[model samples]
Target: MSTLSRVSNTMPTSLSCIDLTVTGALDAATVLGIRQESAKAATDGPILVLLDVAAVTTVGASGVVGLLEVLHLLRARGGDLRLFGSSAALEITRLQAHLGQVTRIYGTREEAVDGGLGPGRARHLAPGFRWHRLFPRRRRTLGWS
Candidate 1:
């Protein structure tokens, strides 16, 4: 497994951009490192986390779940997490399909940062809010009804 490196930059009071470049395989250890980096980047005030994952070569299910967890953490702290990478990245595309409403994805870092930092772009949900709450209930078919 290859290592993941994260570099963070704090923008004037409202945004903290984290560039994560991961090479080789993205495994549990690399995902943990990313979570730690995200925690370190979070602040007391409302902040946006723009993650640049353009350099990541391979990603696993664990990596995706880890990122979703990070996103939840940031949202709970009155912030949001946005991912930017090549549109061809299968892992990223899959994630976008599943969590697009809760998380934003962009094709380029500039686009991600711009969208993430834009006025009224970040959806600040209440702390401890669950993503499932955003969706309406589906009618029971057979078992639970």
Candidate 2:
């Protein structure tokens, strides 16, 4: 079986993040593999698994469900899973009620490891936060095609 995590059986890498990248459709079988690998990696100690989903071609309910299961499994063991890649996929997937509330989706590896906008104030002050309506696209598409 291909090793999905932990290059060494030594101590240093035990508590570090395991980089696991996946491609193709984020389907049942793929998620199952992820879950199993994560389970194995977490067995030794609380581990941080950085999942790269940039190459993933499709998304479905099963993928999201399986992700949640893995997240729960890790957190329960005092570990965590931070996902970085395919902002669109990560954003949509993470936006699911519970997923968004629990996990984070970063656009880059640095953001995932070092950190990014996280645990912010409940109130958001985005462009249209206080007022209603989106910033008219006209503002950005004034002259350009």
Candidate 3:
């Protein structure tokens, strides 16, 4: 079985920023760890998983699928995953293997981090702050068939 390990730098305080350096095969086990780590970071603020795929020259279909699951899970939990330092050969292989669609591609770590974690912008759509257009229902659909 393959493994996905991360060494990260983050603010100790809750509601801050996190930067994780992902390495290895990035399989299901790795995906679970990443999800847990990201969720923990989200309690403070956005999390960034900076995947350094330079060493990972090849990835299997399961690995790619796991990555896609991780991306969507992080997004749903208000965190993100980004790729950095991937080789051209890897890029071509990723495309040829039809795994590119599963993950967002970025040229630089800075760009990925900047794009995912918004620099200094407030989270406007937080819980308990409902939009004016989405009105509350008068009658609740409680256990209706």
- Best of the candidates, lDDT: 2
TM-score of each: 0.64, 0.66, 0.56
Error of 3 at 7 (Å): 4.1
Q: Give lDDT for model 3.
A: 0.59
Candidate order by decreasing TM-score: 2, 1, 3
Number of the candidate with higher lDDT, 2 or 3: 2
lDDT of each: 0.65, 0.67, 0.59
Which regions in candidate 3 have their CA more than 4 angstroms from the true location?
1-16, 43-45, 88-90, 97-99, 116-145
Stretch of 10 with least lDDT, candidate 3: 121-130
Off by over 4 Å in 1: 8-13, 91-97, 116-145
| Model 2 agreement with the true structure over 1-145: per-residue lDDT tens digits | 1223323322233356677777766767778888888888887889887787777766678888888898899989988887878746555655554465556666766566655644652422322132334554444556766
- What's model 2's TM-score? 0.66
Q: lDDT for model 2, on a 0 to 1 scale?
A: 0.67
Give the Å error, residue 50, model 3: 2.3
The CA lDDT at 68 in model 1 is: 79
Q: Lowest summed-lDDT stretch of 10 residues in model 2?
A: 1-10
Candidate 3 lDDT by residue in tens digits, 30-51: 5666667766666765555666
